[model samples]
Target: ILPNVTIRMLLISTIESLSYDSQRYLGNFIKRNDLPIPFTYYLYNNETNLIDYKINFNLLAEVQCLSTEHLIIQVGSPTTIGLESLNTSGSQSLRSGCIDTLFGTAQIDQNKEKSCIIFDVHGTILSGINDTIILALQQYASLQFLYVTEADLETNFLPSMINNSISKPTIVCIFDDHYDKHLHDEHVNLVQQFTNRYRMKNWSHVQWFLIPTKNTWLTQSDNKQYDENERIQTLRSQLSYILQKINQTIIDPTLFRTIFQVQSLYWSLLHYSMNTLNYDSTCYFEVESELKQLFNDLSDTTDNLLITTPISYLQSKIKQNQMDLPRRNKTKFVIDEVQRYENLLKKIDQISDHTQFFIDLLTKRTYMEVLITEKYLEQWRSAYEPRLRSELINEKHKMIHLTSELKRIEMLEKQQKLNKSIDIQQQLQTAKENYEQSYKTLNEIDTKLMNIDMTIGLFFDEILSISDYNSY
Candidate 1:
């Protein structure tokens, strides 16, 4: 093993049948001392038989530590009554094989019994046993040891693990180096069945490696560092592969939910504006443009696989929805215009009271002015005009008498009478001109009143026509 290699080893057996005290002591000793690899001990309940123990073992080995690279040693008599049918060879034979594959040689005590198996800090086997024993180990594993029961693995661990893996990514490796083909198949098939049942294939972030009896175990202690280094490099490569897959496939549910919420809010606001209040197309487009820009900016800010996928999806959805906006706004504008025209008609109809007041004032003023002008005309025609005519006749008679006498003094007196007649004629002419000017003013006022009435009538007609058109 390399100085930096982090190794984990598991020793499992029943408390009753195995040398529990010795295994526990050895595990503690390895953990307490400075060592390159770590060791853990697991003892089945004294009451549990080998069958239940095997089930527990398979559960932990296959599920809990699936992604971990660890050495698992079974410590018990293989020929125990309940376990005899489990494997063709004895438990000692399997232990011997594992030791042989790890250490390349076997060590024996004075009683010819296999002693403790030990690996130095450098992963050199200080003492062990060996021969043609087969060992299986994963070339690449990415996780550390995890202690869990079968029930926990099925009920809690697998579900949570799969969920977490979908968010990020993970690779799990399982090595089935057992001599029994049925046990090997059972171990690999169970995991496959579970993954299939849960639809794990849909998630591209998780990967599974199931290895069957491959004789790729390290044969020499000298090659331990090289093998571990190679495993680490392979794990790094796989991690890169997983990251690439995540970039391609992962969609952020949170981002999608957020975008959906925004889209819903925008639609709600649009509906409210169109149905309840003033709907300004220019203002709506301005707000919509801002929202689009915000979304685009958010998309540009992050390189996270989760955020990017949903952002792209929502952008497309927004684009599709935007295509219908112009048509919807056009309809809204027509509805608004119809509503405004209706309101204008209501306002015009309500002006009847004020219109009557102005009409009465104009008619009364015209009548009063016309009566005053007629009175002035009657004063001129009945009194001032006759007096002037009588004076002129009198002057003419006096002038004729003076002419008949041919006297100079009498003629001068007649000329004075004639001048008086002319002055009266001038006053009558001024009165007639005043009457004509008053009549002209009255006519202009009447024309103005008629124009006002025509304008009011036209306004009403336009409002009614618009109402009828809208109804049609």
Candidate 2:
């Protein structure tokens, strides 16, 4: 009863040439059709004041509506006002971001563009049949497309994500105007501005349609003229064709619910068309009824199988040499390693100059020859005694000692050669071998001790035995 009371509607167009005489003919044609609703169309006319009718007259002044209740249903150029309601993650932008935005890929294909390229969202494109068409299109062209439905993205695209990295989503895409007004007005305006900005570049960037179900008021004798059943039959035929195309194929169960909402909304409009149900009365009875069933069916069918397209996108670009392909980010791993390596190189450079000075002192051999052992020890102590209590060799003293030892060896060798004795040479060789072996063994022992200390420290928190070992 409420649905029949006064079904108000308004259709907005941008064509400037619609004549005033055409308006009366348009009204008569609509009246002759016996439209169930009180339909009021607001089209572009230079003579008429369209501002008062269009819901969004705050901006587009001259192009407006006459009906107060009906909202702006359709915009001729989505760029004008229709797209203002929704955001555009356009195919071009989609192309820039990733590989295989199938629609964007299609845009690259001159053949597909030259042919009929319809972005059918409502009836033919979204559910089952639409997916098959998209798949077929992909076979022929480089395509870029994105989904814009109200289903859970995680539920719909998760399997594709698992199969390939290119499936990672970079932006949000939706068919709705705004996400329930929770979004700030500023943000909404920004999104409109964003869409307009893109539309200016590609007039085809956006497309919108508000499909109102036209119905006739049932007449007593002539009521047979109302093809009510034809509507259901047509809807069924379209749905069946889609189901047939997507027969063995599976889609995200979440996508089913989303697609179901679109279908259900259309289905609910049926009751409204018949003047039996209103919008809030039962939002979308048909969809609400079958959603769970649809979910179960899709879930049972596609269980573990992955889609083919996103998987193709996920393949490594180096392997394919595919241009405009999506790339994976290894930032977390590579960036940290690069930073650590740079810091290590800096520390190495700081120690290099000190090492060079020590090398020079050894080659010069001046400090050891001047030795008073006490004075040599005092100088070493002044440099490092606070850090280590032991009177050990410093770089200066070590160099001096090596220089003195070499001099002694030379003197002994010269004397032994004059005497024609091999004993001194053999003895010196044996001593050098023994000294090298001792140094190697000492280094090994130090390493072993360090490892044991490290092991104990690692276990110290968990093992009380570590404290006892430390005491020992």
In order of listing, the candidates' clash counts read: 7, 19
- TM-score versus the correct structure, for each prediction: 0.18, 0.15
lDDT values for all models = 0.32, 0.29
Off by over 4 Å in 2: 1-116, 119-121, 124-131, 141-143, 157-172, 177-472
Q: List the residue pairs that clash in candidate 1.
A: 78-91, 105-129, 105-130, 106-128, 106-129, 106-130, 107-128
Per-residue lDDT of 35 in model 1: 30
RMSD of each: 44.8, 35.2
Q: Cα lDDT of model 1 overall?
A: 0.32
Q: Which predicted model would earn the best TM-score? A: 1
Tens digits of per-residue lDDT for model 1, 161-214: 333223333444333333223233655453464456557356555554432222
Over 154-235, each residue of candidate 2 has an lDDT whose tens digit, in order, gives 2434223112212211122333333223123545433354444445332232222111112121222343444445434543
